[model samples]
Target: MPHKNLKQTGFDEMNLSPDVFAVLQTVGYEIPTPIQTLTIPRMIECKDLLGQARTGTGKTAAFALPLLSRINLENKRPQVLVVTPTRELAIQVAQSFNDYGAKMKGLNVLAVYGGQSYSVQLNQLKRGAHVIVGTPGRLMDHMRRKTLCLADLTGLVLDEADEMLQMGFIDDVEWILSQIPQPTQIALFSATMPAPIQKIAGKYLKNPEKVIIRQESDVTNTIHQKFLMVKNINKSDALVRILEASFHDGVIVFTRTRNDTMTLTKILEEKGFKTEALNGEIAQAARERTVNRLKNGSIDILVATDVAARGLDVDRISHVINYDMPSKIDPYIHRIGRTGRAGRTGEAILFVQPKEKWMLKQIEKATLRKIEEIALPSNREINEKRMDDFKNKIYQTIGTEDLCVFTDLVESTAKEQDISISQVAAALAKMLQGNTPFLPETMAHKSAAKKKGTKAEIKAKSPVAPKQKQTPARLTPNKIAPTEKGMERYRIEVGHKHGLKPGDVVGAISNESGLESKFIGAINIDYDYSLVDLPFGMPKNIFNLLKMTWVKSQKMSISKYAC
Candidate 1:
């Protein structure tokens, strides 16, 4: 009934099984996280525990290690059942059990969730799993079908209990707990103790040991937080500019739902980025593969919903972008926690709209950090960055790669063409660039007022001459439609004739592709369809995908606009 000390402790001091301790060492876990340090020992002692900790505090291992240690591996009849709110968390918990119990000779762990096939789960259940990690709904189904029996169940853990409550699974959770024997050791972990969660705990838990670990806002101190004010329609366009401007090895873009994840992933891929989507709709096996791909550097960007990205740990992730902000503070914390891990400095960028400034203030208060407001990087800035990168690439190649063959060819070409060596080098550079533009035509213009207090303050302070306003020139036959410099114009089938508005087109493309609206250019509605300006170099696959995307009950039929 008493609380535990919040002192730092080592896993070795917790009196865990040697196999479990050895696996922990192998997994690079040295000292226990705060929650783990406080809760693991009590759990090992078979005490009913009620733990309070935020996500990303290593709560999974705190309960998992103790349960695995207590499991009678030989008698395998689902001795430990971990019920999570979402399929992602269930898979994550099962993976943790497998990892912590790796050296345990006959230990079997299986994750059961709604999206997966019942037959697959039944086969694993019949084969006899020592531990089962599952969502409440699927677990209830199996229990009703008599596919999952709890005759030998010894331990039950309800992870993210508040999340389950918010998801309206508290009744199902209480029912599940009722079915388990009273003697079954229960451990409930939640970020916050709402009335409902507490009521459930009071009824179900018997003299539960309490371990409260508050997540400090300073946990995100290592992350450089920045925000950009963008209109809802321009978010995807803004996102593209940010991605092009920033130097990141790996990035995770968090969305609000599964559909957002898919749409954004398609948009990024069309823009020629190596991206993937993670959501509840994806099968468990495919989810595993996608995460693995992210870790191994096959995919540089991942668009995901909060539920799908729960418990995702990939060390290589350098940036976390909140494309669609979370409604709650806890999820915001969890989303940003994906980066700035393993003692590395990371970046967290949030795209805010005029209406969402209140949420921004809430985040600042919750995190106790001042998120600097930043302007969207102009085309000139992106081009400068590209040039710097190109120069560095050549210098790096000169140091690391053998350029003897290429250098000789360049010299021979220069001599044969009677051109200077510098001209020959420039020619080679242009050839290497192919059709890619070396410089962006125009930058996204920033208002003078927004430039205050930023790095552009000096420029804002400087006086400038005013020019007369003039009508914009029309597009010539040889020219692409005039747009904000750096953006190219394309055509989609849905237009005024199809009862499409600019917002409708923006919403469709932004939601479907994850492109920010700011990056999207002018829309000239035509009789049959519309012509919209989009970023150039869209991948063929993405273009095809957009063609099939619907807008106001009509296929987009998107194509490049040729002058």
Candidate 2:
């Protein structure tokens, strides 16, 4: 049985900031899809969100938009932090923040990973990024440098969190989360929720709000989808232009979920366009009839959910618009494949925000095709396209024989109203609109109004002072002196207040400081610094390397324990 899939519908009702809302409208986003509807409010209220949604259900925006809303542009340190499994995902998540936040002034996002240079990571942290999106390992590196501090953190998001745990990054994540203030709001989004992950959530998150988007809402491979990379803000304005330029017989806007679908549908309808809703909650019989109507040309656009729109055997689906970008690489392949089938090159259009550039890159990576980033169609361009389309509709309507009576009526009305035939055509345009205007008011370009750049340029933050290389002296029992080898005793800055046992000190220093696990002869955690034994009488070079390493939360400089 198909679950009642919800479509993303409207924004006027939500509590999102105007700057964020303006970005959404330009990108053609409607109401909150199910995840957005449920998650957006909670995200704004600073509550922990435990969301259960599949790959393509609009989960990214649900979190990104709200999380970004909390970021203080003036606050220097990382206020919003997201931990993902891999470098690619970390990079993608960072892009999402930039896309939704294109209108938010002074918002900078950086992606951190192991392969990236440490000096580079230090630079970005120092450059005053408002949000930090990174893999656990690199983020841990920042914590050690004290370049990226969490004391002022407002939100901590763990995206695709289960995958991080499965990949042996849970320990790193837990350690990082612990360093953050206990009052931080945490949001965890994963496709499959495992017990271990839930346990971690239970242990860390404050009373969380949980919501799951059904699977059918995800893009189906049987259908085709394609997205465009545009160099501007206000993807929604671009979408309107594209719709006018292209010939789509019937369109179902696949948003992240119900709220998005409804929101988009209402906005389109308000634009005096003929649009209707189709989703999982609608009966199957109604769903089939809707598709049939589209096939027979009774309806030109049916905004529906992926679940409800499935099994739609309509070959006339000339276009599939991805109003919201897909998160994973696979769905993109599936959505674009919906068109250009049966020997026809069907069109697929995606409205990408400034942040969605990475998502576009991933789609290209998956499909092995380079999607061109086109310029936003101007209002003049859209008007011309609409005129061309209207002319085509007229030619097609004239080719059919069923308009005899309507034509006579138009002729008589023209004569009675004492208007020229051209004026009558204009009058019909006004009449068809009736109470609703056919040509919706042209929305202004939003990304242009934004103070932030249309594209986010990746830049290095600041250099963390590399841990000073210690000159190893001779071994002094209680004191740390530079010797031939590294320091005989590893120096620690934390003590009992850190709740660390001797084994904890031993394990952390050994693992991070890179000294042999067995060679850590003695660990004495006193009032301030701890002394850990190591191989002595080596070289000064290795000792210098050890100085750059870090233990649990402290950097192990090769020095004597300071009382």
Candidate 3:
């Protein structure tokens, strides 16, 4: 039977190294997610394993923590290779590896993907990297040119295997796997087990340990989930606008870190909202007091971290605001579950940065619901609400109390100043408004137009759009004329007969010189050598580096070539 319902109270039970555990603590993760609990031990044992979980399930840490602990820092050659389906994921996984292994000095981790300067990657590889994270196509390019040597590779991981198959990269993935040495540990993770992915696993893996994570909770049907596209710098302002416009009885704002709770609570309190901070740093008695305040209407807003807010139930909580998106999807489910309880409707508002659309997508996929995108509350809406509230207070005072004294004072002031009663009332209202603007500048106009740009422009500028693939031009040695501007043609010692392709030469030069591929000019294969154009004014150090670089068992022996 597949591993299910494995109980793990904390990460300590996983036996991870102190350094790795320390990183986890700093990241605010005390307990392991289900996938982490099931996968970490088997990976640490160097067993071939399969983990089936949707995105944002802490899969990166599940594999990364164990692999980081086993890294042999003394040997800098690539020991572990991770294959991702997208450059974004490649970068994210690479960063995670770097973060988790931060305590391990001399741990060299590189992320290789298309659209990045090849020169930088090549230089890093030449210097020696212990771990490499990359997308399939770029990894293949590096492997074919032997820039990414896997002879020392001790383990291999295929993250989001199903995505690779869907993106038509399974063949390249397979070719990459074929290059790994025998008896090397392998792990494959995917959300679903389709036939093709299963075939690759069956062929490549040896009695793999399998763990499948099912959805932990169904997002409450009564909770209407929505997201706002806001920048990090503008989130606090946008959050305030949301509070001012929306009608919420009690709100619980979720932040990622303990310090964030304190910071946001201070900001809200300064805004004159009855707000309190609840985090692990607070004492139990203080926390109880804070909760009691929320219960008795002394505090209507509570800023908290996930751990601190666990097991907290307040029926008055009509809204849940994700001030910081949770690192994992499971926490998101729990965070929103704080509201919409007992068959009552609740609202969950997520503040999403542009780079975090991937996480947003993961939340939607896991929840099986579409989170509607909403614009921030407009200026007119906020001002109107404030004015309505101000008017309602005056009307309530007039209806409930004998206002004879206040009315006589207003009449006396108006008669003495020889002004209309309306003028006197307006003066009092302005004084009551104090420094706060009665009609604040429109919010969405300034934030939306200035910070994010127009919607059409934002969509056009979205990084989610796939980058255009560049196909190398086929060239003969004779056609190497009219070198592109600011580019100098150079000749190398290896060509087609050496089993060299255009990609190999480009990868080799780009890797050696740390020059971006876009700056690298044309390439033409001669009988026994190849000619390629590189950026003008090549540095002596880079030239020397290129001369020593190898491709297809041949030294580059690079020298400037005239057309």
Clashes of each: 12, 54, 4
All candidates' TM-scores? 0.72, 0.42, 0.47
lDDT ranking, best first: 1, 3, 2
Number of the top-ranking candidate, with TM-score as the measure: 1
State the TM-score for model 3: 0.47
Candidate 2 to native Cα RMSD, angstroms:
27.7
Candidate 3 global CA lDDT score: 0.82
- lDDT by candidate, in order shown: 0.82, 0.67, 0.82
Question: Candidate 1: TM-score?
Answer: 0.72
Residue 122 of model 3, lDDT score: 93
Candidate 1 ranges beyond 4 A from true positions = 1-5, 231-233, 257-263, 280-286, 342-344, 391-432, 442-563
Q: Give candidate 2 misplaced runs (Cα > 4 Å).
A: 1-9, 220-563
Question: For residue 476, what is the lDDT in candidate 3?
Answer: 50
- List the candidate numbers ranked by TM-score, top first: 1, 3, 2
